[model samples]
Target: MFQESGVMNSEVVGKRRKAELVFQFRSSLYFVTGNLSVNKDMTEENTLV
Candidate 1:
């Protein structure tokens, strides 16, 4: 029973870690994309002028 509980705890920890990594990755992607979009807009406006 103790071994089973330990395994369960480890599994939960692993899942949480995976979720945190995914969240961080997604947030980074969002910011990078936002920056790129803004940059593109600026470049386009400059070209138009």
Candidate 2:
């Protein structure tokens, strides 16, 4: 029983870690795209001027 519980705990931890990593990756991707759009807008304004 003890060994079974330990395995289950590790599984839970692994899933949680995976979820956190996915969340971090998505947020970073969003940030990068946001920055790119902002930079594009700034360049367009500069060209207009």
Candidate 3:
């Protein structure tokens, strides 16, 4: 029935939201790691100087 379909739709939306959140989390981690590596290189150069 219509009510069942509505419930199913909301469940699908929830799953989609979760997937989006996971994607965002992965991208954030990647960005942070990238920044950390760059900072490490800078720190090393500073130490040498």
Q: In model 3, which regions exceed 4 Å deviation?
A: none
Relative to the unseen true structure, what is the Cα RMSD of model 1?
A: 0.9
The candidate scoring highest on TM-score is 2
lDDT of 1 by residue, 10-34 (tens): 9999999999999999999999999
For all candidates in order, the CA lDDT equals: 1.00, 1.00, 1.00
Estimate, for each residue in 1-49, the C-alpha lDDT of model 3 and write its tens digit.
Answer: 9999999999999999999999999999999999999999999999999
Q: By TM-score, how accurate is candidate 3?
A: 0.88
Clashing pairs in 3: none
Global CA lDDT of candidate 1, please?
A: 1.00
Segments of candidate 1 deviating more than 4 angstroms: none
TM-score of model 1 (CA atoms): 0.88
Please write out the lDDT profile of model 2 over residues 1-49, one tens digit for every residue: 9999999999999999999999999999999999999999999999999
**Per-candidate alpha-carbon RMSD to the true structure:** 0.9, 0.4, 0.9
